[model samples]
Target: AGLSEAGLDLPPMTAEQRRASLELWQRRKAAVLYSVANNLATVAKDHAAAARVYGQLLTLDPGNSERICAALGRLSMQVGDLQSARHHLGRCAQSAPAERRDFYAAQLAVTSADWATAQRLFRSALDSNPGNMLAANNLAVICLYTGQLREAIRLLESLLERQPKLAIHEGLVFNLCTMYDLESSKSVGKKTRLLETVARHRGDNFDVAAFKF
Candidate 1:
């Protein structure tokens, strides 16, 4: 009946032949769905519409692929559909490839204010790949948020030492300055030097009034 509805004639066939035919039909349907979703995403730039089409494709494939979940997760995040983003990104994190999965899921968790999960994911990413500077920086931020100032300082300092160019990173410098101000009574000279260095890097357009010591 389903094949007939799609204008396919049923031929007399063995069980294996019928199974192969159904499989082919399902594959063709999935290809069509993927094409439509790509067109919606690229041509129309309609993230929501593309996400819906991907959701439909997921129903048909049902855990057969993680690419669809990842795409849908990113699209949902772009559209501010946090619930859908969490669901799809969580699925992707569990089933997809390792590269960037934990980082992206942690980011989404941060957006949702699920601080514990974000911290856990960031930490997990760091543990899995100790060279992940982004994960280390994000975890350091969580430590700062929770008032683990010393830990944040240590983490950021380690990062900056490993890549001294990171000293020019505004966020890292800001956090370092804050930590120094809060933890060190003798930080006035150090803070002044840090700000001066930043100002030098930024050149003439840098407004001294914008920075309050």
Candidate 2:
């Protein structure tokens, strides 16, 4: 599709480049435009435009519609657009692979504050694939919200221990520390231990502020 030649495969670093990519996308409607859309959302931080491009991709690349829908769903969530998140994530779950359907469905449940349904879906996703850190993290959140504090703590801690790479996950660390704060008055010691553990695993790349100590 001449994508590399047009620089559409690379991140557009400036507004002029982004405009050029958008113009090309409007004219081409190629599935390769996903790279441009991803860079627009991730690098340029223009989520609305990225969502628009992904919407177009749903038609241009029906074979990857579920993936595009998932991207749009996450973008909607990041922008606090719960209505759109529910719509897109539900679409994703409808056609996504069996192994991935529950995660998208769980994300859809989150948009409506259906914690019980979300908990069930996320737990199912994690059970099916223990490497699904997002599913595990969300399930832990539902548990915490449902007043199962110890269960939440155990889930996150055990997952982190099993997958040390999760030490760099900001949301997981923050939520775990929040649980520690709620579970006991002696939370600083726990947070300190968490910080040490993460530091040991990730060196200096992990943000210290995520622990909220």
Candidate 3:
């Protein structure tokens, strides 16, 4: 109304801005649709639908699409679509740059509790960087979860030696003992000594003084 009185109204949309706006809308629309489909498929236990939605999202935004594919593969695995899961994960793994590929692929395998695969990947990561505590810790967890009691203990022990008095070691000791039952774990002389130090609170957390990674 004020514009009319001033003989000045809003100008028509510019072609470039309009085009950009339209593209943005399309991207947002695609994202929303894919998100909705993914949620619905999760609720309905429809891994195929979820995969399709993720595929569409990739089409809409090719950059950073690896995460989307990884998510789709996770759902596919949940629904027993092993083939589809493998296919999507393979694509994501291959498309990822060398630096990021191993982590993503390792994560995918870890999600599925493919401990053997995780072990291999974690080794590769460690070989790449011997001081990668994160990789070492994750490998220890995988071992513990997969019934490799001795291996898990050895991992924690080594880390303790490398970085003693670390609080995370306490948690690791707790998990290992809880998993294997302290008695069974301590049945071995090496394990007994490790657990005794942990239980006695000699150094707190990791007790680096007594061991080396």
Ranking by lDDT: 2, 1, 3
Candidate 2's residue-wise lDDT over 1-213, tens digit each?
Answer: 536445556653587886886766654666458888989997899999999888788777777777888899899998999999988888888888899998998898889899999999999999999978888888998898898999999999989889877888877898999899899988999898888888877888876888887
Query: In the order shown, what is each candidate's alpha-carbon RMSD?
Result: 10.5, 7.6, 10.1
Candidate closer to the true structure by lDDT (higher is better), 2 or 3 = 2
The best candidate by lDDT is 2
Global lDDT of model 1: 0.76
- Give the Cα lDDT of each candidate: 0.76, 0.85, 0.67
Q: Which stretches of candidate 2 lie over 4 Å from their true place?
A: 1-46, 56-64
Poorest lDDT segment (10 consecutive residues) of candidate 3: 204-213
Local error of candidate 3 at residue 54 (angstroms): 1.1
Q: What tens-digit string does per-residue lDDT give for candidate 3 at 126-158?
A: 667666666676777788777786787677667
Q: Name the candidate, 1 or 3, with the larger TM-score value.
A: 3
Top TM-score: which candidate number? 2
lDDT of 3: 0.67
**TM-score of model 3 vs. true structure:** 0.52
